[model samples]
Target: MSEDFKKKFDDVLNKIKRELDSIAKRIDEYLEKGEIYRAYRIWRDAVLDSLKMLRNALNTLGEEFKDIKFSEDDLNNIAKYTREGIREIVDKLEEIGNRIRELRGRGYLWIWFDLKPIKDLFQEVAEEVNVTMDGVLSHVEKFISSLEKAFEDTGRRASQVVSVRIKEKDLELIDRLVEVGIFRSRSEAVAFFTRRGIESSKDWIEKALEHAKKIKELQEAIRREIGGEEGEEDKENQGKP
Candidate 1:
């Protein structure tokens, strides 16, 4: 990935980390207040939201990585690992939810004073989630590092290099485009847009010629009508004179 894209991806991961930290903090606050239900709700929502954000970040990173040509086996391994991680988190979340529901069904009111077993279960599950999240985060960082190294190695292997001068504003635009996954690099963006413009220019020319032809035909029809009317009028006048 380009520097701009890497920065954006890092921003996304940082936001997710902050959000997860906030959620964990809120869970602790609720638990301290003896509001077990509130804590549980917060935990559930946090897990769901975190998973969603992580998945989105992974997908975005995957798109960015596609720009770098990598081995199919490496790509497949990454995808498989990601899917397994998500699945494990989802399963754990579901298990926690089901345990909570079972306790609720058994007349457990979640009062802090007498709910030792439930509290223990909650803590256990929460710890597991924390561990899982940490693992996932670590794996993601490693994955990114590996990709970066691969990109560097690929660059080193390339035998040809081309340099071009670009205006500052155009460079900014290219960076934005790269950040948005429009192109892998400025060179790619330039090549793709140039090719598209060349291909579309031919189409545009053809359409313009078609329109010109239609206009010519219409003008000829109008001229014929006007000339025929004038000739008729002239003949009538000549006969009268």
Candidate 2:
């Protein structure tokens, strides 16, 4: 019976080692490839495997792991990290969203002038658009300032409530976006737009492209007019000479 138990224990240990090695390899590959989405998936699987291993080890020790309680400090620390990560992600997403909104407004402003009668365009719309743009840019400026202040405020107990809790659904939404190449990762998507003040809120890039073509046409027309005038001057000079 003693020999049999020893053999079983050795098998379980080997199985656990294999699981850990696989998890570690996955992590290394994800990190090397800079694949944040894959990294998160691997990390989650590793956590699940670790929990299972812990349970099995506890079982081997003749204790029911599920019945074991966590200390208050452990729970609190977990909550703190979880809350901080969620809040950071949400803040980044919102920053990207605000940028997209601003770009959409610019797109609309450009379109509103497209051969439309001056009388048909609402004066209120024009005024509101300007006001909204100012407001958003101002917010962006303030956010840059407050962002530093936020780091300072983090350790204050009063600011703990400011943390956002990211749920599994939030991560799922980001993962789907990542798969489509709209984002390399949730962090990249958030970082790219937040710094540039753009977002996936609307097809602003297409609109901007259209707007750019129109401006180019206008510039070419102006250049042709100037060239024509120069030609006319040359002709007059030739006749006078």
Candidate 3:
């Protein structure tokens, strides 16, 4: 499950991991220069300037998807990962956050001259962590939504063999694809183009679907109106002046 999701979204996940590493390094620098609290309005977190939490979070993210292949583009393999693996990641992050909050009450980072900023700094830091976590969750949600749509589209396209009656020119184009070694046979060429067309015009396809639904609703409404009028006419006729 983990490997499957990682494969489909390897590029995205790599970018995210790199970004995390960059951010972690920046925070480590802050801890080194003793500017941690200054930047955070009081006190804050870290990456590798002597910290276990930061290492754990970064490692958890990186180690899971290391050495992944981009070979599998199918969603069926990743559907389980979408549900389980994603939750595992989110849960790991939440665990890190919970640890931070647990330590927040200890006045560890509260070391200061007057100790007046302790409460404020702790609250601010926790709030920042929560906000960051929220952003992560939101990004995951959007990614999952995209995967779901892709899965739905794939399912529709791959349900059965579509017997399409093509014009000669279209058939010739399919044959050309085969001739160029782009596909093994006419069936492969057709399937590839059919999927490609759906993918390329996915937005338009969604809009068309929306319009079709509205059209169905409109037809139903018109039928209901006609039925109501018929009921009125029947009542009048039965009443017979």
Candidate 4:
């Protein structure tokens, strides 16, 4: 990941974490004062905002980790679990909406807005979201760690993660390789074939890309010179182990 991208990702993730905490506090304050009606709009607005944030977070994860394929020990069904979590949260939010509307429809009865049920609902949703968000956050943080680790130690034999889309036939071919025990996993099979394919094109690539290689070398030299001029910081001070 690029430095600019890492900064933006951190900002987005922090905003999401802050938003959820703030939403709960705001709603609780209104509910505590026996202002169920006042909490209604806050609840509705929070739902919309939360949904937007959830989607943005998911999209960011997908984009940032698009190349980082997960093994069974890594990110498992990120899109699926995150989407399902979003759906459940939305459904809970909808239930809260319906309850608020029902109370509002009564419109005039002092006793109609019991507030207890909705309060319970707020608690339920909080618990649900906390559990779901924990999973999402852990996976993202893990991805960031993995990305940084790989980038920093190019020569280290780290367990790299790569994710990508494949056609039906392509997926079947990968699976077939795994089934035959030629590879331990779909990731392994994909990596093997991909490396092999690149090697097969080495001759043509070298012949046709001579100018490009020189340009790339120039860019690398410039980057190296800039690093030297700046006196690179210690990894330990930068939060490395």
Residues 159-231, candidate 1, lDDT per residue (tens digit)? 1121123344544654555554445554465455445543444465446556666777899999999999999
**Candidate 4 per-residue lDDT over residues 152-210, each given as its tens digit:** 34212211211133344555655654554445655455555566653464465445455
Give lDDT tens digits, candidate 2, residues 159-222: 2321222235544654555554556655565445445544353365446545666777899999
* Alpha carbon lDDT at 154, candidate 1: 31
Off by over 4 Å in 3: 1-6, 38-76, 83-241
lDDT agreement with native, every candidate: 0.49, 0.41, 0.42, 0.48
The prediction achieving the highest TM-score against the true structure is 2
Output the TM-score of candidate 3: 0.24
In TM-score terms, candidate 1 sits at: 0.31
Off by over 4 Å in 1: 1-18, 84-241
Scanning candidate 4 in windows of ten residues, the lowest lDDT window is 154-163
Those runs of model 4 whose alpha carbons end farther than 4 Å from true positions after fitting are: 1-25, 28-37, 70-76, 104-241
Q: Candidate 4: global Cα-lDDT?
A: 0.48
